[model samples]
Target chain A: MTTEHGAVKTGDVVARVEDLHVHFSVSRSAPVRAVDGVSLEVRRGETLGLVGESGSGKSTTGLALLRLVDATGGRVEVGGQDVTDWSRRRVRSLRRRVSMVFQDPAASLDPRLTVGASITEPLIVHDLAASRDARRSRVAELLEMVGLRADMADRRPHEMSGGQKQRVGIARALAGEPDLIVLDEPIASLDLSVQAQIMNLLRGLQEQLGLTYLFISHDLAAVEHMSDRVAVMYLGRIVETGTPEQIYRNPAHPYTAALLSAVPTADPEAERRRRRITLHGDVPSPVNPPSGCRFRTRCPAARDNCATTDPELYEVEPGHRAACLYAVEAVEEMRAGAATTP
Target chain B: MSEPVLSIENLSVSFSSRRGVARVVDGVDWEVHPGQTLAVVGESGSGKSMTVLAATGLSPRGAKVGGTVRLRGEDLGAMSEVERRRARGRHVGFVYQDPMTSLNPVMPVGRQVTEASEEHLGLRGDDARSRAVELLDMVGIPSPEQRVDNYPHQFSGGMRQRVVIAMALANDPELLIADEATTALDVTTQAQILELVESLQERLGTAVVWITHDLGVVAGIADQVAVMYGGRILEHGTVDHIFGSPGHPYTQALLAARPQPGVRADRLATIPGAPPVPHQLPPGCAFYPRCPVRGDERCRTEEPPLTEIAPGHRVRTFYRAPHSGIERPAS
Candidate 1:
């Protein structure tokens, strides 16, 4: 697990999940297998980006990591402690180790509370501050740390813009000084420029505080940029995991290739020449996912083998793995074919 | 080139409030030719939507709309309310971002679309129904005859959007206005929608005004691009010129801020402040406060007129800084 700057050591795992599953029984219908048998790890001081489209269980996985959603089956170990089925008392201790920045800042923060109150709420919950003054000053310090002015702390969430409310959300997430932070689509709804601001802030904070992040989003471009390691999820399963270069430059999975090609770039000439792999259908429902390989229905290179036997994640390169039979050769062929298409 | 399908001269939209009048779309001018797609790119509240709404007489009541909107040389501004509505329905079509809200939940998808065809195209009952099905099939909805009777909720997000596109194209107007139509869908689904629109435009020869904040989508389909900020277009150019050598600093920053798939940066090129509020926009250049390369007092004291910087490329700025990457800090 050698990284660019050697900031993340190979074995220093901050959080780990083993064969996790989260099922929901909605409207008395069949159980929805939102997160089905997924497992991954977040190394200390490195961001692991979880990306997928809607109903792919990326958000559910993020919630399960902090025990906000009960684990139907499997174990979640954070900071070397099993927290899968932690009691209320045990979960409180887990909260001190793990905090989350929700997708919608407006809904996450209490509308009635001031920004200062919201930022200090976590500190007071875990009793991290010795005194009210200590908590107050820490709130101010956090505001400054997230590049917000101290005076804005007195304003409520409605008084600020979306970007400012997100800043408050980050300040609150940092109040506990957790070892790991789970950011669930933090910039999905923000504008392009504001999204850039938040991404820059997240990167800077991770570097400065040595904090590990499990950044989850459907935005593939953002996930690629922010993640030290990228995990592509499809219908509640991790289809591929690798470094940005491996995932973006030489994607092993057909799904990853389709996603990369789907994202239209800012260069017009390149777009004109780009041969898009147009996936013809919507994401199949997770309740009744495809029988064998989940993406077999949409996978262009799917075969008879894909329908009966589920392929586990296989290593294609150092620190890179994909759960597809044609990941190695077909993807290379497709890449070469695309480059010379026009 | 053939006559422009839609042209607006000095178009502006303002709403009166207790505080004062909030001018959202301020003195905007643009033209969309038949069979060409013009992308209006902007952040939220940048008046991209308002410009189209006002030009097509869809803005909210009590809002003040100024300037002339001419579609096919017909003065839409001088038309009476009923005449304006008829002209808009017959000549212009609209598709919004969220298909669920724009579509009727209780109405069957078939009926919802045929209503537009019946009202605008004047096709009778059987004619409207069959035309609706054909339009749905054209938008790539499978088994359109069977699925036409299903409610909007029965359809998936992408299919619902396809239905919306069907509704937009049922009348086969000369112009189609899609405001953030594909922004809500997944990347793959967005690609499908973009391709669908491109093919439809090719077949029907309808002009398109695509309003979105995603430059990637702009690069993919737009013939010309307009970058909007603070309810005004800051830059306008052909897609090649805009992507190749963006003439404005804001345009440059917007391009730099996009997180490319293979590109990694420790810090994204940040534009420091949020877009100026409509009511509180600065007197001169609306983007001056957040501009990386500051223009002199001329930019501060007076608004810069749109100046042609290249063939078919215009920039609204006094500063002629190099179109370098968005690394220089916001002034």
Candidate 2:
């Protein structure tokens, strides 16, 4: 597929994953493939939504990007430098350029440390700020940037609300002045209104700081609003990649279609009119994924070919790509049929 | 019209915080008829949970509750602690968000379910055990007898939730309070849990109070809905009325804020500002700060009481006009 809107140029790639694979050894026989041969890029000043259900390697991918979990194979390049083989000291230096905001803010933030100290510690550890005075000033500035009051710095994580603590987490992630931020469900714990505020703050910060984001989330709607481009993952591989409009309006992958259909429409009349595609059965165990195409089990349009041959991601439209053999023809036919029906 | 199975009127709950008396739930009113699901929708700290929590006398210590919670024409608030305890597990059952936390980790699933029945219904040993296995099977847990002996840790997230539901229904309570029961489950499991709940409601004719923040989940399950903000009910109406013709700005913003799958907007109409803290609520409409349709002095100075808009729909907006053609009662 050719580069579309917000597609990262080779030079603009802030973080690049090349054939990354992460596997965990569980006994002597075989290993659980948490992330398998995933390749994607986070561009400067762009949000790439990495979306999937549980056990789809979304979290593992984020972890692999940060090198928190060692990838069994392939390379991770940050800012044109291959950090995949970096030492502890080198990795620590690299951490200053890449930071992560966890899904659960309450669990991520230290209970013993005050919010101020937590944010400032990152600055001090990374040597981003010169002195105590500088670190404090940076912490306060970051907090204010995230719309948190300066006085809240002294409070513990438990004392603050879920949204407030999440803001603190964002502030801490920003303390090192990282060019790339891996946001794993940053607003999942917050309320709808609060989520909006946080998302707006994130977008504003990205604009002001030129931050690159690898945004991972299960909430497709939030992802659509936040992401410039999206990668849909099933099991441990990227099944489709496209712009939000392309994915939402003309999803080629059947799993993508079912996921989009499952989201409830706010408009009652529209909801009644729309046909919801329900995928039967839960996600298969990642420990033992299905043969050939992993999505074949739940895919509505699955054929005998899908069970024997894994389809590579092929361009269905100008820039939209899907990893299913029949997706291109089927999607085109469906669109044409819809146009004629109306 | 038939009387509601559960009616909560003029409900107020105050917690004695170190700062001062914080009104967690203030002047909330709600009703649920037999076989109907009433979803109390709100964000965290919106008092939706506290309102229902107070009804069952389940509020933490040092919290003072003042309200009339009438269940089947009986005032639950008037009862003593012992009486309320007996009434709670017997007539009113509660399901929490994290099933793992609610169910005992060490105890077998069968023992847990039987414990509820034994305590509330006075069923003993073999009888309670038999009933427990039956309840498990009813909730769609396969091989109830064998699975019942398994610990909570052995069950999947969805199965754990099913175990919780089985325990909740052990006494066959008339009113079931599900406090974000399906929040922790995946979408597919959520669908199954909701289907189970709906089917159970049909079979038992039990009134359900589902408290959640996910508008999508509520749309699937709720027959009636109440949108709460800043410890107050901002809008209360039938599901069709609330979703189709939202009267309050908060409710409208909530509906608009949700990102549906296919709907693409330039930007989601997100209401700015977080929900106000309990101690720091604005004097006027609790939602005035974030309300898109802000009126003049009235919305900022004096609080608006929940006024009827139609036969069953009510809204707490001083602005009499409904934004989307829903009729409002004359002041």
Candidate 3:
């Protein structure tokens, strides 16, 4: 699936995963099926938001693509090249095509290293810059791209604020000039006001550099704003996939609907008027997930069929799919209900 | 309105640090009536938590606490240390962000729940056990009698929070303080907890002080909101007033900065510059550096008082806030 000269044309699939699985073996216990039979496609120059709660395996799926975690089964293709079974040594070249921005920037960066060195390390490792002077200039350019001052290059991680550290992290990720970036909860640690700043910088950088993003965050509102399309993950599977409009407006899966309804809008009037669906019981242990449907234990719309049969992704509309037996009916009912509402 | 369940006046908390005196909660004043919920909203270091800590007599060691805190019309400042501690357990209850930290890991859930009842209500043995089960059942914990024996680790994150809530209500305190109680749970679980708290509040008529950084949560749960910045209350008003007709630049910027559930925009409205540190706070308005609307030079040199712009609404800024049809009365 390698493109000519590693050049992925616009609208091409920059990264694709087919039935990917990442399982960790826990001693004296059942293996944790972190990423079980997941499939996704991230297109060139588009941000695909991965929205999920904790223990949903979204981060594991992202790590699987970067070969940080080994895929126990299935295939992963990044930049049109299959890296599913690639060793750590062979995976180094793949890093040049894909990079990651972690949730905590302070943890991701070295406290001792200057911001410039942190950004330049990737360039040196990837051999993107030929000389030391070239690396220095490239580091400055990368910092400027992330809305940080060139003078910030000399500052240490502890010397900067949370937002500034995140900017440095983004600069380091951009240093590799990767075709795709997996932003795993990039703005989760920053303050509310600073979150907007980092988000805007990311969007601007994406537009300027034509970088594809796999934006992973638990914040549903943020995912809706940034993604052209969104995939809702529950337990270890992608339960729903659609454009932000379709997914947020008319969620086909019950889990998606419950998650959406749970988020209170910033407006008081709307929040008070909105109908909230409270799920009974907590999420089942991932080690021993509920039979058939993983969300059946807590789903408000669960039926006998949900407990008996494992559902697969079924198309509720063009480019919109949900892994529920009642997807088609649910979508139709929601749409009809919405149309009738005053 | 009936008498306030908890009233704080000119509450100030400062710690003597190596760098300087860090005035964390500076002259905060508010009141919460019975069955009312006041959300103290702010980012980290904004002193929302410090204000609550000082009011509850839980301020850290070597910290100076000034002003009066009245619980159920009794002044806390005048009470002795032992009296204040006893009053805190009987009149006020707390639930923090992490349930693990609040609950005793080694103790049975029922034992932890019964401790408050035993100490505050003088319920002993069977009476305490029955009360524990009853409280747990009220919090929607299924099979309360059986689950009461379980330890904190046995229950899930959401269920643990439920147990914590049950314990908080064990003493039947008139005031409850939940500081980011549901922030750690999943959205579905958070919804369940929020519903549980709301229902409990309704049934028990407990006034609640909800301290959080999430504006959306504030909109859903709060009757009144106090926006804090750099250890000062920039704005205090009803939820409608704060969200619909903000009278402070900081409040307006925060409302605009947050990404609403349904609205999608190319770029979010942002407040430039970082929030101020407590020690280095400027003498003028705390939000002046990041405020989008700075009216005049006076705002940079003098701290404006919290002046009422409307009945039950106040803004601490020299800039004339756009009040629409309602005119600001001269202060």
Candidate 3 C-alpha lDDT tens digits along B1-331: 8999999999998988799999898999999999999999999899999899999999989889999999999999889999998999988889999999999999999989989878877999888888888988999999999998999999999999999998888888999999999888888888888888888899899999999999889989999999999999999999999987888878887877877666788899898878888998988988888878877788899999999999999989999555431223455
Candidate 2, pairs of clashing residues = none
TM-score-wise, the better of 2 and 3 is: 3
| TM agreement with the true structure for every prediction | 0.96, 0.88, 0.95
Chain B TM-scores across candidates: 0.96, 0.95, 0.96
Q: Lowest lDDT 10-mer window, candidate 3 chain A?
A: A1-10
lDDT of each: 0.88, 0.83, 0.88
User: After best superposition, candidate 3 residue B246: deviation in angstroms?
Assistant: 0.6
- The true-versus-predicted C-alpha distance at residue B89 of model 1, in Å, is 1.2
Per-candidate RMSD vs. true structure?
A: 3.3, 4.5, 4.0
Winning candidate number (TM-score) = 1
lDDT of 1 by residue, B1-331 (tens): 8999999999999988987889999989899999999999999889999999998988999889999999888999788999988888887888999999889899999988878778877798788788888988999999999988899999999999999988888888899999999999999999999999998999999999999998889989999898889888899899977887888889888898888655686778889878888998889999899889987887787999989988788999998569643232355
- In terms of lDDT, the poorest run of 10 residues in model 3 chain B is B321-330
The fnat score for candidate 2 comes to 0.43
DockQ for all candidate structures vs. native: 0.74, 0.39, 0.63
Please give the lDDT score for candidate 1. 0.88
Off by over 4 Å in 3: A1-11, A331-342, B321-331
Candidate 3 lDDT, A7-122, residue by residue in tens: 23535899988888788899989988888888888998889999999999999989887899989988999877888888788899888788999999999999999999999898
Per model, state how many residue pairs clash: 0, 0, 0
